[model samples]
Each structure stands twice: as structure tokens, then as C-alpha cells.
Target: MIIGTVDCFPTKSTLSKLSINNSQNATGHWNSKIQFGHRTVNKQGSPLDFKLEQAIVSGERDDFVLITANFTVPPRSTLPVDYELIPGVGYYKLHKEPQDWHTARVICNKEGAHLAIINSHFELSVIKMLYNRDPKLHDFSYVGISDLQKHKTFVTIFDEPLNATGYTNWAPDQPNYDGNCVVVKRDGQLFDTQCNGRFPFFCEQTLGK
Candidate 1:
């Protein structure tokens, strides 16, 4: 039911019953000067006739309805993202395309303040949903954090320490000796990979204002 435009006109009997004569205004707009039935009946018996004391053409009526309907839609309070959020860790999404770790980081950075950070098993569960359609389920996705510094053991998008003691859920052999960047795999597991290796990445951000 995709109705584009509809012109609602009063039935001939309705117009005759209303006894509207010379009801057309100078602007060629219909006017409901004549009253009949329980309500005023103009050439066009639009709801606006009751509101505006006028008879409008079909197009004007449609525009009025559209504007009214738009005003009725509840304002969206939250930001736009296609995934649910974990209470603390961050929002989780499955990687879809091949992207280098750096590019992935940028994508997440654009998403919000916190950037993409995965730390708990529950967060991983949400990431796994992205890989359900793919047969070759990978281990983790590329998060915003990386350990590019020679002295740093771990790095976060915020340039903070990985803080291995808290909110860290690295998989076995993760942050491998040669691997300098972190990415979350489709399986919700964190793994270290060459920073240049392209893979899908997820973005993270804080919820609400």
C-alpha cells in the first residue's frame, strides 16, 4: 500500500446537499462556506476544512497530513548505530569487509568517544553474530587499541595502557611477539595480527550523552 497522492473530493450528492455556490476562492482554493450534514461540506471535505475554515485541494491536504504525521513521530533519543551495547565494555559489531587494522581503527574512532574496545566474553557474543553467515569464522575483530610503541606492552585508542589486570580478555598467544596490533575476530576472540593485514573491524563508543 504505497499511496503517493490521493485527491479526495466530496461526492456529487455531498456537494449538492451542501448547497455550496461560488465557493471557489480568488486563489482557486476551495472554501467550505456552505454547511451540510453533521459537518461543513466543501468541494473537498478534508479534515483541515474543520480546522482552517477552508476547502483545500488534494495536494495541499496531503502535504498537511504529511507534516502532521511527521510531527507525531517520536524523536529518537539515542545515537545511530546498528548494534546493541554491553554495559561497560562497549558496543560490539561483527566485521564485514577486509580492512587494515589502522583503517579499522579510524572507522571506530569516527563512531564515538570511546572507540571500539572489547574486554569481556559477553561482548564477544555480540561480535559472533556477524560471523554467523560466514563459513570461515575468524577469531577476533580489529579494535581501536594497538601496541605500536616499542616500550608499550599494550595500547588503547585513548592512548592508555592495556592495563592487563583489568578489563582485558586477550586470547592465548595473543599480542604475539611479532603482532603489534589487536583485532577482534568474528568468534569474539582477541588476536594479534600484523598491523597491515586487512580485516573487518568493529567500532566502540559510550552509550547516551
Candidate 2:
């Protein structure tokens, strides 16, 4: 009785190192092949001795061979590429490209995420760290706060009041502008800005609330 389960958790760098081969079968069907030979490690940097022999994956119109080592990746370890999961918080992606608030929201929505809404000081710190990862990501980035519906009454994309997020650390004398959109500075403080102004933004996908 051999029951096996496979989980895949590859980082951006690891994915780039993978070799994918596409070839046609004898029945004139294309088969996808992925080879993984790199060392697998856990969070503690300990090497895991798990090797894959071969796996046949049933496809819609065809079948493919998935070859890998014997490894068990828990559900929590599996996450979408390009998103960094903050424990007890959520997954976040920082877009370097500048986009207006509305455009940013639309893009995030398309990706099954929303413009990032700060929930706590810890979350705010994580966002600040991500925002400062690249030197080109200077200045501020658009978040999910806006006063579009009512003047000076900021609400998140989820329609929750900004104050309810438990993180209302606004920049010194900020909200000074007669703007509807909000931006979080590198220092982890919020500021009101015009919705039409282009800026890099953060997208967040939350798990069970």
C-alpha cells in the first residue's frame, strides 16, 4: 500500500533554475516534462533526502510525466510565486511599476488580490520592509485607503474604516492635501494623495480571516 502526496514550493530563483522540456508523444500529443535535481532544504537549512522516480499526471487531452524526488510539502509551504507570505498576516506583492490608484486597484483585482490594507503595526513594518527592498522603489506607494465616497472619511477597498485596521500612523501633518487616495511612505506612515497620481503599489491576498 504505497500512498504518495506531492507538494511543490519553488522560489523565483529556484523556478528559474528548473529545466522544462516539451515533446510530442507517439500519438501526436504534446507532453510537458519538468526536471528538478537541485538540493531541497527546509527553513532550518537542513538537507532533505527525497528523490522522485517518475510520476504520470493525467491531463485534459493528454498525459505528462512529472519526475521528482520523494518529498512532502505541507499546504502552508505552498504559495503563489512573487508573493511573500507574512506569518499570521497575509501574502503581499509589491509592484515596481507606477500606476494610478484606480489602475492599481484594477490590476490587483485581476490578480485575485486587493490594494494592500494595513492591519497592524507588524503588518505595516512588513510592508515597509518590502517597499524598501529595491533602491528604485523610493518614496511612497499607493495602498487601499481612500476618501472617494466622503470627504476626509477614509475607507479601505473592503469598505472598512481605516481606523478599524488598528494602524493609523499617519505622516506628520499629513492628509494635508485635498486628495482622495492614500499612499504609505517608506517610513510606514500614511499620506493622502490624488487618486490619479501614478505610484508603485502593493497588492495583498489574505487567507482565513
Best TM-score among the predictions, by candidate number: 2
Flag regions of model 2 displaced more than 4 Å: 1-80
lDDT of 2: 0.77
Give the least accurate 10-residue stretch of model 2, judged by summed lDDT. Answer: 40-49
Supply candidate 2's per-residue lDDT for 2: 18
Q: Residues 119-169, candidate 1: write the lDDT tens digits.
A: 555655655655676767544457767778763377776677777424576
Cα lDDT of model 2 by residue, 43-126, tens digit: 532222355588799999999887665643222333346777665567789999999999999998887778999888888888
Give the C-alpha lDDT of model 1: 0.54
TM-score of 2: 0.62
Best by lDDT: 2
Each candidate's number of clashing pairs is 11, 4
